[model samples]
Target chain A: MNDAFILAGIRDVARKHVGWEGPIEPDMRLVEDLSLDSIKLLTLAIEVENRFQICLDPERDHELITVRDLVAAISHQISDTQKPEEENSHRDTEDTE
Target chain B: MNIASVGSALPPHFYDQETLLAALRANWTQRHHNVDRLEALHRNVLVGGRHLALPIEEYDNLKTWGDSNDAWTRVAQDVGETAILRALEKAGLGVDDVDALIFVTVTGVATPSIDARLMNRLHLPPRVKRMPIFGLGCVAGAAGIARAADYVRAYPDQVAVLLSVELCSLTLQRQDLSIPNLIASGLFGDGAAAAVVVGAERRADGPQVIDSRSIFYPDSEEVMGWDISESGFKIVLSAGVPEVVKHYLGRDVDAFLDDHGLSRSDIRSWVSHPGGPKVLTAMEEALELPDGALDVTWNSLRSVGNLSSTSVLMVLEDTMSDHRPEPGSLGLMLAMGPGFCSELVLLRW
Candidate 1:
């Protein structure tokens, strides 16, 4: 998984949702720096999920604060789910051989 | 018609943005899963502090709509009277001088309405005309003044008072975890404002009401309003509010000014109702106003949030007290509210 791509997607969703025109550095705090309120954050979560083809745990939203944190969470979810599927397919191929 | 003087009354219970956010979180955390979202929404409104009609702790015990609105009826009287007295004092007028009373609010309902109640409480003249308006929401402040101006313009010897009292905290729905309710919780504050409009023959010293325009967007009721039910006034706010402003406000202002043989640049000052950041930004863009044209509006939002129908009047009061535009300067006061409509009043100081 490309972390940069995930970061870019998060930035795009944030920009569109909150109208954040400034730069989105990894260190920029969502609440303090960008003024991303709760509704905007929720909208961003849904947008990120749609763009990255990942299901985010709404329950864990409190932990997703910074840009890096959001991107890492999405990347971790994608890798964890995709790796299991890949391993299952490889195991099936080996059994067929 | 002249707005002789304006005054405001805010409850003593004021809290900065963080303390209010913390209180809202403490109340809603158990029922709502998104405390983070609540905090963000509250902070993003950019409201510095607000005056609550009741003490913050008492809000928890408002168990029913009856209890909340009962509080509204009681508090609405107290603040409404205070605001009216201050406005009259500033205008060098008394209750007897007021020929008409226009009370505007949307936070609660009363059978006799606050105007009649005030007339009874203050011993205003029995012949005083009463116009109590409800459900106009934020725009009622400007619209009420416009109507009062109209009243005085017709009767050149009469004086009219527009009083608005909005207890926004009393309308909070504890059970509703919707985004609009959350935004409403942060963006709207409790307060009252009154403006005295004197007829031309009285020769009062104040800005003259040049003209007014009310534009109702047909079939746009769902854009920004309330959906009342057994519980209380549930918010019907939409993201499209800014879109509506961007589309309609510019054309509305241009047509309005052109009708008066003026244009946007000719207006030297603006007394805009600060709905929120988005709406103000949209207003600035739509009207193509220069920098600092809406500073008073942003200052009001930061200080008091949106006081519903009382907001624009509060801004007008601030303008009259602090930022008095030079005499002969052109100004505009405007607000948009539940009717999905805008009220524009042109002024010359």
Candidate 2:
């Protein structure tokens, strides 16, 4: 999914779980700005994983405090997977031409 | 009036320590953590087993607060009625003799509250005054006795009944994996305790309640509290609890005793709520109690775990049944709760 899609989903989940009413910006902190409890944060992480088919470890990834962190993590995973597919597509196009 | 009689009732379902530990381990693993610290914490608690209102299989099916509330209500009624009846029989008094009923519990909420339901179910006199206390947490037992004593002091011919039914096991949250929840699940048990306090003028064969006092610590609200969530009543038990108990218990005890023109040495027996191992140790250290001063309290904790509002009453019942004080002796009842508050009751045997 695109960055806007992921941010919107995170904002919606935060609103539902933590009663967050403020605007969702890329720099907003999950704990301080959103006031999400630990339990709600865990639930939010699970929801993000299920929606994007990517797993993010809360313990190892310590910088996942803002929407930018979530977008960067998802974008990294998507680009890493797209590399091999892009090469294969190039090869197929060369053979067809 | 003295605690003339006491009785306890527990649900039929029993979960041994090992079995509960194993289930907790499984649940904790699902939440992603090493269970070593939790296991050690459980071992230190000294609880061998606890009773649950429903079997383990049905625990997961409780999806809403209403469901758990309903289950707790049913068990509370059954256990409360049974304990009250047993206490009445032991006191050689009938339900009609009770002039006031004080019901205490934190595990569930009710529209009519448990006190009203008990009044209707047990056919208590319509004129009997009702006071249903919530949010006192574990301290309700000692507070209930203190409140009852206060009532009987004004009307020395009336008898008061204090009922505490805590189905702590019913509030188990399957999804939450916080350390507080884990510790609370293992430390608390399901039980009901009822004590009949007769006024001095109406006392036939029991001790006399002399005085009562309540003490509150300022700026300590977050030390212990409950977080009511969709899952269940998630406990927010901070580690500073033992420290809080150690800091204030001695002063509170001394003040309470002094108000009654007595001291700790004058009391021959102590009825204290068994909040947990650390809490007991803190109390023992703060008061400099003798080695066996809290034997009944420790035994109650080991046998029934912390029944929240019902724990101290069970200890009082045990003390009354096994070790009756001499005619001129004195007894002290003490308990602490979420408000970081303490209640003390002085009785003369």
Candidate 3:
């Protein structure tokens, strides 16, 4: 749910799925610095989705260029999906009260 | 030398991308965790469907290299013959007219070679020059055209036919779960294509070869190729392929054009091998092509997947039949393959 957790998830995805043993800094570009091709990026997306159990909108792939961008996107995706359930819970509590 | 015609043949069996992906997932999911990776990889190649040398169910019967290769030889002869005959027919010629026969393929091997075997089937001249080129991989389409051009240039009165038969499905490594093998399983398909090239003195209504160039990058052998083992050919496709294309293709093409008093803007047609989506995108970016410049190539990739050496020839065939450019327009046929090499053939319609 947090940035650190998402960042660590991305690192694992990069290393395990993409075979990148180098350091994955926040500023490192996925294609240029990390050498992730389109296939690698897709693999990373799926692996990250499995790790975090959240669906990533491939439509937003263009906006995710760096490790920081991916971490932020995952965080944002988690928050966006959580908001609906959170709102439903609040509505249910209010009805009960 | 003029390319009088191009003929292509896909096997009788065809399957949509979804079916193919399902088959692959079923095969790989047992050993592979996250079988979704296979799904994503198969879907992202942008191939709508593909043809297999045999029916999908029959592939399971091929349990060894010998078995698959035997199928390759049999089907290759059939498909290759059809392509050659079609090409010759389109050129208004017959088997007796072919002075040179060049056979190119990386998917399988043979002792007497397909060209040699086809002599009895097609009933060609006994003395017809035969050249069986192996291991060019994807570049053999352009490279074969270049070599045929060379032959016709020397003979000046002869006709040359280049046949490329790539049954990529036969070369699949079922046991290997390597990244390259996974990608290859999704990206490549089965097909054969033949190009009829006539000499300068011959009368043919088609694109003429103006010039050709071959460029080999050092220390990049690991970029894209195969690693042959007892099982069969294991693909060695690295993620560095697009990088190689981005780094070299544009500059090499520019220089080749410069030598002939032309530029990128002068080219009206771009007949390129559809390596995959990323390779095509890298080509478009590196060449600074206008939008839709590779529309035909993309269409071919989508319809049949990448046919190895036959891909560019199929693109050329489409260009000739449907997407024909205006008279006096220029075209370039190019492809990159093993040896981490590229072959460029300049043409004029």
Tell me, by DockQ, which candidate is best: 3
Ranking by lDDT: 3, 1, 2
Q: How many collisions per candidate?
A: 3, 0, 0
- The C-alpha local distance difference test score for the whole of candidate 2 amounts to 0.82
Q: How do the residues B240-286 of candidate 3 rate in per-residue lDDT, one tens digit apiece?
A: 87989999999999999999988999998999999999999999999
lDDT of 2 by residue, B1-349 (tens): 6667887888888888888898778877664443554576687789988888788778777888888998888889999999999999999999899999999989999979888999999999999999999899988998988888888878888889999999998887868765567778889999999988877777556666777888888887877878878766888776666777788888888887887777788888888999899889998999988889999999988877899989898888888778777888888888999888888888777
Per-residue accuracy of model 1 over B244-311 as CA lDDT, tens digit each:
89999999999999998999989998999899999999999999999999999899999989998898
- Global lDDT of model 3: 0.92
lDDT of 1 at A36: 69
Which stretches in model 3 have alpha-carbon errors above 4 Å?
Answer: A1-97
Docking quality tier of model 3 = incorrect
* Predicted candidate 1 versus true structure: per-residue lDDT over A14-92, tens digit per residue: 7765568788887777777877665567767766766676767777889987888887899998998799999999999
Model 3 residue B255 lDDT score:
97
Native-referenced TM-scores of chain A, all candidate models: 0.89, 0.71, 0.92
DockQ of each: 0.07, 0.04, 0.15
Report the number of the highest-lDDT candidate.
3
